[model samples]
Every structure is written in C-alpha cells, then in structure tokens.
Target: MNVYMKEQEIKTKLSAWVAGQSSGYHADSVPFDLRIIEQRIITSVQIMELILFLEHLRGEPINPMQIKPGAFSTINSIYQHFFIEGQAYA
Candidate 1:
C-alpha cells in the first residue's frame, strides 16, 4: 500500500483500539490528534497494552530505546513514531 493508505489503515486500527478503551467512544469518535494519555482515554496500565498492540501492527518487536515520552500520546504521534519514523512495517 502507498503511504497515505498505510497511514490511514494504521489510524483506523489505532482509533478502533483507542475507542475500545472506554464507553461513549467509537472508532470514528477518536480524533487523530486527541491526547489519549492526558485525557485518560488510556490509563497507565493500558499503555503497555497499547505498545504491544502497536508492535503487533508493525509485525515485530519494538525497540525499547525507540519508546519515548509522548510517543503514544495520540494516534497521530503513534503513527508517526512507529510507522513513519520507525519504517519497520513499511
């Protein structure tokens, strides 16, 4: 897939996962730029789960050093970090 399509696919998966975190939210309701961590849409305990999910999407293990603060802060950030920057799945 091309970059935009891949990015969109990643966003959709991320949105679906994030939306599953709580009630009153749907995949379409989760904004790409939403602050998932600060807003507590994803709690601290679930952050690890999110990372694992991301790794699953990438089809490989993520490097520990690549993880940084705010990397999982939003769907956009996560996509940029793992898909664009990491380029592992691509």
Candidate 2:
C-alpha cells in the first residue's frame, strides 16, 4: 500500500512532541514559526529526550555525527531533516 503522510500530519506530531517538553507552552499556543530554534524554549534535558523520541519514531539510530545545531532548531527544521531529507520514515 502506498501511504502518504502530509506535512501537517508531521507538523502535528512534532508539535505534540514539543509540547511535551519543558517549553511551558501548549503546542497550539505557539506560533508556527519554523525558524524558531530549540535553544529559545527547549532545555538540554528536553533536547536529549527529543533525540530519543526521534530515534524511536524513525525506527533507526540517529548518527550523532549527522546531528547539527540546525537540525533541532524548529519544528519545520526537524521535519525537513527527517522527512524531507528521507532520513526517517513516517
């Protein structure tokens, strides 16, 4: 079967994950600013948690060397790195 995952779906999942972080803001409350970096809201612990979450979600180990500051900068940045770049499965 051909499964198509929409960008909004991906964004929703990512937004939900971000909400689980210590950002102190609801997922829906945050503006959909793709340019917002993780450093602005996410804590170090949250970033680690996000890494584990992404690894599990992608069903593969994310190489540490491949991770960049820009990778986890924003929801859209993460989406682009994992989904658009074909590094992760839906």
lDDT of each: 0.84, 0.68
Question: Candidate 1 regions off by >4 Å?
Answer: 87-90
Worst 10 residues of 1 by lDDT: 81-90
Residue 50 displacement (Å), model 1: 0.6
Distance from true position, residue 54, model 2, in Å?
A: 0.9
Task: Point to the candidate with the largest TM-score.
Answer: 1
Q: Which ten residues in a row have the lowest lDDT in candidate 2?
A: 30-39
Return the TM-score for each candidate structure. 0.88, 0.72
TM value for model 1: 0.88
Superposed model 2: Cα runs more than 4 Å off: 1-5, 34-39, 86-90
Give the per-residue lDDT of model 2 (tens digit) for 1-90.
223457776677778777766457677654446444534577666777877787777777777567755777788788778767746333
Give the clash count for model 1: 0
Clashing pairs in 1: none
CA error at residue 38 for candidate 2, angstroms: 5.8
